[model samples]
Target: MNLKTAWIWGLVSAVLAAGALAAPAASAETLRICSDPDNLPYSKAEGAEHGLYVDLANLVAQKLGAQPRYVWWLSMNQRKALRNTILAGKCDAYFALPADKDYGTRGMKRTQAFLDVAYAVVAPPSFSFSRLADLKGKRIGVGFASTPQIVLAAQGGYTTVTYRTDAEILAALDKGEIDVAFMWGPAAGYDNLTRYHGRWRVTPVAGEHMDHQVAVAVPAKDAALLARIDAALTELRPQITALADKYGFPQGQPVAVGMAQVQAGPADVALVPTAAGGTPYGQPSPYRMMAVAAADPAAAGRELFNSTCSHCHSPNGASPIRARDLRRLKGKYGDDWLKEAKQTIEEGRPDAGMPTWGGTLKEDQINDILAFFKTIQNN
Candidate 1:
């Protein structure tokens, strides 16, 4: 169903459900959540209702014993629209706020942030960039009106190309249209590693406003509603983290991989294609494809790394900070390296500053990522 219609239906559902419970039914407990329709790794209509946030909403509904309804709002131009919905009583809460002071109003209350995310860089393998400074003179892609554009525009120097969504930006990156792209952390990281075969380095930037907390917005008119949400959030935060890990959003730092001697690996390397595959760039593979177009799994891994992961990791599996070189992971990481690599490749280090890949990267592709790690340092 269309997003607009779905919204109206959802609101109706909530009010009707509340009405069915008899007049003045104890404490008012129906919760209507307003969110974006197409914002992925955050909220969506398909699987997991779009990720951790939706799941968290479900958890909250269960905790409150209230009917959970959804309202799909356009992500851009959200503030004014949200205010209208809340004041009109169409929605009890609006999630995905930047937790900014600007959000609160006469009928709006802000809950503590359950998720903290930021803008990050997604680049192809052949390019090299260890730090923010490496973006110099390089062409970078950005989503229009996103934090990345705002920051880079002020920072100056590098050439900036703009797109409207993470899908579009990643497509361009895959096609060599841009040297790098700055995008929403979870969406970018998950899409790249899984759909793109871990073929890109998603690097988070550190600075003012780069990282922001996501909170639930409630109608200021209902103090009780606000407090309930806050309490529910406290109860559900840990579950929320687990949900984020279930997807491929990076929790901590970006994965690092060195390019030195790390050529393409085997053809058996299972690769994941971006969501936008086939229609525009290329068709999405029913079966996984190698990160690189090489026949050798290791060589393909190396090619993929150099074309993508190498941008953030060192040439010989080292990174100054933002990313860690994968090749250095073996001996340096000790006996736990394999298991750690698997976890890092699959779950992503959410607490330790890494995105999970368990949901995104296929087993073979992950094997390729690990194989590439082993090739270096030992060589």
Candidate 2:
């Protein structure tokens, strides 16, 4: 089986195992959860205590005959803080940790995941992305140590601006400083919905690489505690989900990003004709400056499309993965599809893997791409 399929089954099996071992007929006791004080949608020391990890801690505490307590700490060096608090008996659990060895190798154990987080690309409503390639040349806002930065680094060509916090990233996004903001699912979703009043479109990237399972953290020696918490988590899954929704965690159908395409040599396409001079389709089209750029819109489109879009969305309308079919725009998109296509091209359907292009591509270039779409209209 593929790695994704394997991981899915593994999750199912793990859940089942936890369910079989859940604590029975329990009464509540006090359980301390070490969390970051300022981080919202994940943990917060202030009123309501509605973050996913905090809520999950409460649920686990209730299931295990415990009351929940807050232990505020900085998130910069999570491992050291966890060791000092949860491991040292200052707290019983550390809610919300990446379920990987790399996170806290020193002395921490993780329970089966109670939550799954994926990277989201937040953009203007006009943009709709269908794949990673769609993000090329665009400026994206990302958080330090966040998954988006990792993904962006792997896919070069895009200009990624890093920030220390989600608030910084959001500010940049709102100020039109960045075309797209790569953010954590819970924090980004809540802020966008509450602060931005649902003005932004936040889409989650599917697949294992982008998927993050959040689990409870405990001391390394506490295997029994781990197993019991895992069981409690199995019983508290429903409650956990409810809290996630209450705090504005994004839980929607997975959107398919553009498919991965084979690499091709850069095309020498000219930008669409303009009053001053011509430009190229892709960013910094060298040919346009060199006077060797394609003069016709179709040729320019063909060249740029081959070099960039074709990498994921195939030149002949096929792709390595199941991304949008370029040839089928006419069949799939009607008059409404034009607007949809424009939105997809500009903002990108990030949930599906498309990156926003609002600041990256010129209006004329986007029009040229649209015109090219007319030529390859799927039957």
Question: Which parts of model 2 have CA positions greater than 4 angstroms off?
Answer: 1-28, 137-139, 143-154, 159-165, 206-211, 253-379
What tens digits encode model 2's per-residue C-alpha lDDT throughout 275-320?
2211110001111211222356655555445434553476744564
Which ten residues in a row are the worst by lDDT in model 2?
Answer: 277-286
lDDT of 1 by residue, 1-379 (tens): 3333443444566566568654334343557787666666667766534656666776776677765687766555554556557667888787667575653445677888777666677776666656666787877877643445544443445466756457878997888878888776677877875688878766665444355566888877778878888899898767887887776665756333222111232334432322221111011112223334345566655544443344346443467663475655666678888888787768767787565656455677667667777777542
Output the TM-score of candidate 2: 0.55
Give lDDT per model, in order: 0.61, 0.62
lDDT of model 1, residue 164: 45
TM-score of structure candidate 1: 0.55
